[model samples]
Target: MRHIQRIHINVKSFICPNCAKSFKDNDTLQTHIKYIHECERNFCCRECEKTFVSSSDLNRHTQMVHMNLRRFLCSTCGKTFHTSSNAKRHFDEVCGKKEKKNGNS
Candidate 1:
């Protein structure tokens, strides 16, 4: 016969005072406060003068639209896409085998 012991631990959560939103971590709650509650748009695009909350978003926008960087390439058709989601959508809707619905092929 074997004996087993179980232990319970409590996790501390960070809560937003303004909207009463709760997060498991403090950094995520701080980021949400800075971006959503503060409405900060510090990052700006040089090409179109658009603003963004973060630098990564600005860089992605510039690469996708201005620099025309299509990093996601489809293996079946060799087609390029700006984002991975777009490439996956193309593969699922066009290249991959799909099931027919309501007698429509």
Candidate 2:
């Protein structure tokens, strides 16, 4: 209820002192401060030694880049992409012609 009131109502109460950016909640503001302002990346990728602000980001990087997991396949072009947005972009932007269907990667 609080989230809906804050986010849906566009009431950004928490303002970042450094950049003057507003956020819906304190946790988001803290996360933005920790990652953007302080540049404190805690989640490290063992595969590439790259660091990220959150564990989800590290997991995404590992799965997409290191694992080569192309799960989002373009229905029209039959091309595989690492993410759903990428596949949707292909379908929207360039996947007009039906390319030879490759089995799911």
Candidate 3:
């Protein structure tokens, strides 16, 4: 007879000391600390000389501003957006039937 052993894998979490924000990985936690707490902008845009906290933000800026790429489009209003979230926001705020309270809408 042979004996079999099982191993358990735990979900590793990294916590921020300042704001108590949690992350799944150490690299993500470090990045959050560097960008949010430390205010480090290592990524720079060559076109407009703007600094960004991450490369993804710089790439988004370049695509939207320099490349003029509007990938997300609103079906109702025929408006275009660079990101999906913005289009969704427009739909919720402008197009959706949800009532506006406190003069916000």
Span of ten consecutive residues with least summed lDDT in model 2: 96-105
TM-score of each: 0.60, 0.61, 0.53
lDDT of 1 at 13: 59
Per candidate, the number of residue pairs that clash is 0, 0, 0
Give residue 61's error in model 2 in angstroms: 1.0
For model 1, residues 1-105, the per-residue Cα lDDT tens digits are 111211133343578988988775677789889889998799999999999988999999999999999999988779999999999999788766433433334
lDDT for predicted candidate 1 compared with the true structure: 0.80
What is residue 17's positional error in candidate 3, in angstroms? 8.9
TM-score of 2: 0.61
Q: Provide the lDDT at 77 for model 1.
A: 79
Model 3 agreement with the true structure over 1-105: per-residue lDDT tens digits: 111211133443579998998776677889888879999788999999999987999998999999999999988678999989999999888766433543435
* Full-model lDDT for every candidate: 0.80, 0.85, 0.80
Candidate maximizing lDDT: 2
